[model samples]
Target: MIKKALAWLECGEIKRLDWYGHEGNPSQLLGDKQWPQRLLPLLITGKLQMRVPSIHTLGSYQNWLGYSGSNLAVQNPKLNISSIIKTKEPDFNELKFHLTGMAGDGNKGHIWLLRLMQELLNRENQTNKEITSNLRKVKLHFIGLEIDKSASLARELRYWGRAIMGENFDWTAHGNHQDTIRSMAKANIAVSCSKAETFSMASLEAMHLGNLLLRNRTGGWEEQLLDGINGFDLGETEQKPGKKEIELVHRLRNTLITPSKKLTAMSIAANKHSQIFQNIKYANWLLN
Candidate 1:
């Protein structure tokens, strides 16, 4: 099927091929073969145009072609931030944390989440006597909705999460985009644990909805997040427990200790920063 499609693409009078690489993509498959030799000529001669979502993707193509083309760069449609409204400030008693994506083994970082939740639970138990009443009762509720057909993985992860987090974790394997957005509005924090991404619309939507974002400092997120300001830079801590993971857990714990006013202010700042990716600005960029 991929060979036939590639043959057609090579022979067809197609002017442009806007490629978005994903798992099981034909371009990736063909690129591993000899598609670059066939496509590079067309690309260099301005007969074909290629656009990807991020510099990381562009770099991949450049490496495949053994040269960079003028047409290849990071470009993606702007997010519709119009539907996103500022959520009400969360109280200290219960704080909702959200993660939305495929529950696949490679995509979502479920293990990291389980570890973080365990750390939070341990912190609460250890500091129960020393903390204030509000802090003592504070609970971090994790709401995860799998957007792909990874039901079994989601179920398995949920079992582990429950073991680690007790009553604080919830997982849904079948969820639509609307359901995810609705849940995001109620969340105090939105986490993105993907090892790599082109452009994370979920993280952007979370920011637009005034949810504090904690995302890995890689891919398009590097362009979007302002470390320690709009969001925290989550480094590689998923494989093994490290300082970054500990710092993230500490920051979440500090949220319970911080005043509501300060947290609200931070949320507002995050929302404002996210406006750069709104539809209006995106449309203008397209026109220009």
Candidate 2:
């Protein structure tokens, strides 16, 4: 919309522009960057509007707004929430994990899958006595476009994981959104790894499901994940597999290692916190 807003506004086709985004301002929109309509007072004045899905983005993307002329950004960014009906998780004895929104490389789907599989391999080494209640026969499911053929290391790890863990540890890859939602309904935990984001929908959905989130705190995630409250805190996103990634899995592996007072409280808090977002009426939010 940024690219075409100038032309449309100049042509008098779009008098005012309202752009909505879930992520932070694009890199191109930062620094000494120009909004195409900036120079033309008649076309630019009160014409370029950015509507971020979360108000938290206002503070998070402050730098971007600085160089990009924040005068036009007077309106508050509103939170965009979906009405996902809270469903009851199915009765199951085994551990179930839902890796949140692996929408291809941007979300680093392959990295998350590999780290989880690596942790599962670690669990395979432990005997039934060594394994905790959370480690016995685990199941993880993710749905999205598959990683490209060039992701050799990730693919190799997955191969080894399935070969060693066999049916005892099922890591299912899916493509259907409906099925993924259903799978989430059955999961007890969620691991959503993203390079960057601002109040992501996937994270919101996971919280609404009463699933304990296990993601590296990124962007506005801090506003939702209260460290060991609703989710464990990792430093940041990583391009390579590292301790943080493994620690994420390790945390999940023994989330109930000794059963702390925070377990059910975390889920309850996550569900409760997400409900604030759910209450938002998008149209009314945008207008007001």
The 10-residue segment of model 1 with minimum total lDDT is: 279-288
lDDT tens digits by residue: candidate 1, 1-288: 545545666677454444444422335566465677777776676555566655555666677777685754456547785565556755433556777776666476766766676766676667656453445232333445444544677667767877776676666544566666777787777777776676678888888888777777545666567776766777754564566676565555564555566666667877887787664343332332
* Root-mean-square deviation of Cα positions for candidate 2 versus the true structure, in angstroms: 4.9
Candidate 2 residue-wise lDDT, 107-223, digit = tens = 545455555566656755663754554553467655443466764544554565466456544444544655566667777677766776666666667777887777665555656
Q: Best candidate, lDDT-wise?
A: 1
Model 2 scores a TM of 0.71
Question: What is the number of residue pairs that collide in model 2?
Answer: 0
lDDT of each: 0.64, 0.57
Error (Å) of candidate 2 at residue 100 is 3.7
